[model samples]
Target: MSIKNITVLGSGIMGHGIAQVSAMAGYKVVLRDIEQKFLDKAMEKVKWSLQKFAEKNKISKEEVDIFYNNITPLVDLQTAIGSADLIIEAVPEDFDLKKKVYQELNSLAEKNIIFASNTSTLPITELSKLTDRPDKFIGVHFFNPPQLMKLVEVIPGIGTDSKVTEEVTNYINKINKRPVICKKDVSGFIVNRVFIPMVHEALYSMERDNVSMEVIDSAVKYKLEFPMGIFELADYTGLDVVYKASYEMNLRDKAVLLLHPRIKQLYDSHDLGQKTGKGFYEYKGDNYERIDLTPEKASKYDPYSIIGVATNNASWLIDNEVCTIEDLNIALKLGMGLKMDIFDFFKKNGPDNIMNKLLELESKYGSFYHPNQYLYSIK
Candidate 1:
């Protein structure tokens, strides 16, 4: 079936951008929020986004005007979905608010309407049970600043109909976004599941005295060429938000962000990163010079960077039938933008040579250095 009428909930950044994109893609879009002020803010966000596209010559200014004309800002949810073929909810992470929105949609939207959530961590399958038509429920998880990021994790729950899944996937791709299908539901889905833990591990690496923040950040940027060092990214992305999301995922353990088990205890004592001006490294004065950095001050934790490396060893999971080698490499390159020099050469050196390097790494780092059991067991 063709999707022509679209409705998006929540007038936050994600909701507004989703509405703008659908409108640009030639669908009538209704953007709804609980209040007029929120809707007004969301409309301004959408207009500015379209203007940026015009400035870059990606689309004409006239096109932005047309896109604005196609968007209808409504404060009423029921009226917003008057002719919706798909309704994507991009509300806050509060579970109660999401549940209430779904309940409202359940009584109002037509039987064929598809409901999707832009939740970063909540389970789509569990949330589907709140609707009368579970068959129409799906997850269209967009990365932040959706207009720029190209990928969308399309998660279909146990109750989701296969036809609906295919239709929505096609619709997302039509608007020029890559849709990576995830089987069933898992905490943080796939992207966040893998990415967040890596960030935590890097923090621990510095906390345990195995590496200094400057050194770790330097090694990643200069030697490994990661887009951003782990600790630096935490500051840039807001350590407080990451800390909250981690605690939410890990059962209120504050140590995960601190990279030490006592992090929460310390954070509660006003040791939270950047946001508090203290965190892992103390920001002294107005220029943000790091003041408190020493093995004694920050390195009292454990060294677990090897675990992070081991997790990235493609052979470990692939050879064991956990995931295909192709998907593993794609996840690293496409998702994380990582390209290990050893892995790059290993492709040309073949399996034996790759196995040998893993051996060397294991000898230097620890057991995490070894490839998955399948690699060692190979004849």
Candidate 2:
């Protein structure tokens, strides 16, 4: 099915970005929120972002106005979704709230209107069950700031129609973004499943080895060639988001995906990273300033310990058929902004070296670090 008119159901951070990118892609976008003030604020941010694109010469000033004008901000849900061919739900991550929204959408939207969610960690299968048309529902997991992020994970529920998945994949491509298919509707999908454990290991190392956040961040940034250190990225992503994702993943796999105490502490205190001016590191204000991680500090921590955990999770995903090695590599490189795939590092460091690190981590951190069958086979 062809999707022309798109209705975005929220006006929050992810919602607005989704709308912005949709508009930029020349789709007629209705950006809807419950409150008029919220809609107004979202539109202003969209305008500001469009202006930035013009300033960067990515788009002409005329094109900025044209794209910005493509989006129509509205408070009426029925009116916003009335002419939509696709309804992308960017609402808050609360399951109950999303269920209610889908119920309302079900009652109001046309029968053929495809439904999509921009959920980061929630299972697409469970969410699809809430809608009348499970075959029409899918997960389009966009990273933070959808307009800027190139990676969009296309996840299909068990009940989701394959044709629907293909159409959405094509739509994502039309928006000038990289689309990676997550074959199974697993918790954390592909990117978070493999990456979150790496973040957890970083936190664990800090607590266990007395490694400073700066040292860990430095090692990840300099040694691993990631754009940001794991701690810095956590702070930038907001500790609450990171904690909630970890919490959700843990709920599904309690033994393996346990939450880190440091993350929980930050979340409990509401020091939610850059948004709150503090998390693992302090930010000056609402503006995000990258933490200065000195390369000299990289020597204090072995970045391979973190990579070992990530490689294990990647192996688990591959073994379970959640995604292919090629897709996982693309997802991590694009979604996490890594210089190279985790598997590349795994191969470079060699299976024996990575296995030894995993064994060491397993001894220190319980069975979660235990290498999987794939790792053993390689060894």
Q: Which stretches of candidate 1 lie over 4 Å from their true place?
A: 251-335, 339-379
Best TM-score goes to which candidate? 2
Best by lDDT: 2
Provide the overall lDDT of each model, using Cα atoms, as 2-decimal numbers: 0.67, 0.87
- lDDT for model 2, on a 0 to 1 scale? 0.87
Can you give the lDDT of residue 258 in candidate 2?
50
Task: Give the per-residue lDDT digits (tens) of candidate 1, residues 169-197.
Answer: 89988888777776646555555554565
**For candidate 2, lDDT tens digit of each residue in 199-247?**
8889877877788889999988887788999988888888888888898
Clashes (backbone N, CA, C under 3 Å), per candidate, total 1, 0
> What's the C-alpha lDDT at position 205 in model 1?
61
Residue 177: error of model 1 in Å?
A: 0.7
